[model samples]
Target: MRFTSCCGGAGAKTLVLVGKAGNGKSATGNTIIGRRVFESKRSLAGVTSTCQLETATLSNGQIINVIDTPGLFDSSVEPRLLATEIAQCIKMAKDGIHGVLLVLSIGNRFSEEEASAFASLCQIFGHEIADYMIVVFAHGDLLEDNQCLEDFWGPNCPQLLTDIMAMCGKRAVVFDNMTKDEDKISRQRKELLSLVEAVVKNNGGKSYVNYLFEALNMSEMDLIDQTSEVTCSEKSHEGKKFHIKYEEQFEQLIKMVELRLGECIMRLEKQLAEERVARLEVELKAQAAQTKSKEEMIEMKERLERAEELSKKLEEKFKNAENQSKEKASETIWSRMGCIIM
Candidate 1:
């Protein structure tokens, strides 16, 4: 990550781009920088498989820092790997982000998986991410009859997009990613900058601030204090006029966070329960094997005892027969002695 602009602070703005694979996230980043800094090509998968930072001086005089990230919520990417990459992304936005461009393609299906990916930023980085977020629709040329984006806004549009618009204060912009016209580019860029300004003003001219990475450096008590501040700050800030319509949306985002957390806990508990059942099944089998061995040993001991008893009876009978033979021999010897005396 590098910042090449001459000035910093108020003159600068940081934006992060997030979306599913092949959703034109990289193209949006390129368009933002006024150059093809990121590779935009036809593909079924994401070209930027990791975080890439690029900076440029926009016509609006804002030094824009764009962090283009991979499809973090794509099914192909491992969750553990995605977590590491997302942390890297937050590190790049160390100064806090002024805008989060949730990119999506126009005239395409927004599946539930993609919707969750759209919502995951709030779920992972805390609901504060939504305060500075806006949806940018790529491939704007796909609209039929040269229709405007607003015309595609009502109930007739995809429900996911509608829900997403409601989440980000209905702050969205359209772009033809393939368009090379400088005038159109400048116009769209200004619209995007205006949206960014709204987010910044909503936060009292401050960027989106979160302690996810900062918490790693703080002590337990310090982290607790930080969390307390964040919780209190969330309650204290009702937001500026820019966010007035979306106040309830922010509240809903918090509730969504709680629901997501609850869902995670339930999944973990169910997993643990399944593991316990599997372990108990294994233990029961071992116990049964041990019991069978003990029973076999007892049966062998009883069979040995019966064999010994029969041997003892045979020995007693043999001894009695020997004694009777000896007595008969003695009587014969006495009869022979009497005959000799006569």
Candidate 2:
């Protein structure tokens, strides 16, 4: 993979762009890779027709494998099948896919489809994939009606967006695909680089930091809610504020590291689980075939034993007939002799 901005990280970072259909995931992929690697065209119905692997190399030498998939939540399609396709992509890109960009249209509200996609991510990559994910809002300029994207997704928006950001570690950026913006892309790439570096520094950095931050965030919340008024003073309050900020910044670095590590581990575990499941399925089929073969062999053995018993009975009857004929001939010979003597 070409990385123009070198962080000298340990491994290649695979950035996956995922979203609902017609959300411009393919286009954003083309923009980042600096070419139209994926097939993008408008059709009568809202759908991205490219369901194959499309890859390109960036100027930075990063190998960008952009998987153009069918719409995640098409009303006409089966949900389980769509989920399977997503799973296939995940397996294919399991080697180095480091970042996940959950592309969202700035103008459109987050829908149940988007929520379903989010759930799929959690299901496929575990709840931790959200940590390495960036909520990339496409068509940022459309949010001009809302005055600001931040304000619109601010303190009073629906819980879905809040849940998304919270699950995604509140790490998000808006990208105007119409304006052909590159700023957010660059920022995203840099953040990815930092994450890679941190992952190299400590293999468990991502998961560890996330756990640490969750603890700290909980503690911060507790400090505000659980403390008695008499126990806290004005000076102590300011000191606590400064301490929280400092601790947060310190923990932020740790969290970023942990997030990357968590991503790496999650990818490995997912791949292993997939492999294990496939292997077990194959073994089961083979065992069934073997069992059938064993049953056929037992039936053949029984048939052979019955044929042998019938053969023995026929030989005994033939012997008895031959002996009777000999005895009768002897009696006839004796009678003829007696007649000749008389």
Candidate 3:
């Protein structure tokens, strides 16, 4: 995340400057970059109509990439166009942005149009940007005697501006971009980079990523995803350990359910077995009753045959007696007739 290429092999810092038009935005860029790369002329139409980016090594031997946006916060340009321009600026900082310098003119009145840029920046980048942000009071040469950065911006400053700076961790700096004093400019740029380095250090050497920046460019999202995966991996490892700790308890629960189910099945089988035994006893009783009935039927049949034979014998005796009586009656009739003839 450091650039050692510029300024004869010094480490780098990527900076993006944002503010209203004619607020010395380009001049501030030239100061940090240590060159006249950006167009810094005053005009009714304003200088730098579109976004321009340049990189240079500062007098501190630190390479800084500056993206100067034109009318990004000014009311002259359309909001849609400004949005496009801002996106282009972010695209140039794909290496990762360490600082978002909110450039405000030292003495000018902050207009409603410029005041609205704070909200727009949030929409474009994300809320996290304001965390490590630094407020640059551009045109710092206008400061009167006994009037410092905070006293001027704090006492009568617009409540909106105060709140915007508060979002930047209450950090601010002054830049005399017009000053030709080589020593003063050098000191200012050095302090500015030092403040930026503190922010990076507090953030653990990582740049602030706007969640919305992901949709603006794929690389930001990939960076977030990679970081998230690493974070998730650490948490997942902890989760795996927790799972292992409870594995024995989980097995015990399963075994308890299985044992209970086995007991239920055994009870059902015993009930079925009892029913089968009762059924068999009933069948055996029925077979015994049937056998007794058959035996009684055979005995009754034999008794009936005996009764018929007894009745035939009785009938023969009665017929023999009747025949003897009839013979006697015939003899008496013959004797009576013979006596009458004599």
Output the number of the TM-score-best candidate.
1
Clashing pairs in 1: none
Considering lDDT, where higher is better, how would the candidates rank from best to worst? 1, 3, 2
lDDT tens readout by residue for model 1, 1-342: 111112234578889998888889998888889888998887877788789999998654669999999887675665555656766676677667888998888756777667767656666676667777898999887876668887775456878777877888989899877887889998888899888987877777777655543432233344345445555456445234224533443344434444554454455557668979999999999999999999999999998898899888888888888898899999999999999999
Estimate the lDDT of model 2: 0.60
Please write out the lDDT profile of model 3 over residues 1-342, one tens digit for every residue. 122111112357778888877788888889888878999965435688777878886545667788888776554555456555655665676556788888888767876556556765654455677766898988787887657877666678888787887788878889988789989888888888888888777666766554323333454444445445555558677556545544543344334333433444455557668979999999999999998999888888878878888777777777777777777777788788788978
Model 1 ranges off by over 4 Å: 1-9, 144-146, 216-342
**Segments in model 2 whose C-alpha atoms lie over 4 Å from true places:** 1-11, 41-45, 73-75, 145-148, 180-342
TM-score of each: 0.61, 0.49, 0.57
What is the lDDT, from 0 to 100, of the residue 91 in candidate 1?
A: 61
State, as a TM-score between 0 and 1, how close model 3 is to the true structure.
0.57
Which of 2 and 3 is ahead in TM-score? 3
Q: What digit string (tens of lDDT, one per residue) describes model 2 on residues 218-335?
A: 5556555544443546657766776676466545544543454445445555766897999999999999999999999999999999989988889998899999999999999999
Distance (Å) between predicted and true CA of 103, model 2? 1.1
**Between the candidate structures 1 and 3, which one is better when assessed by lDDT?**
1
State the displacement of the C-alpha of residue 5, model 2, in Å, after optimal TM-score superposition: 23
Report the C-alpha displacement of residue 185, candidate 2, in angstroms.
6.8
Comparing 1 and 2 on lDDT, the stronger one: 1
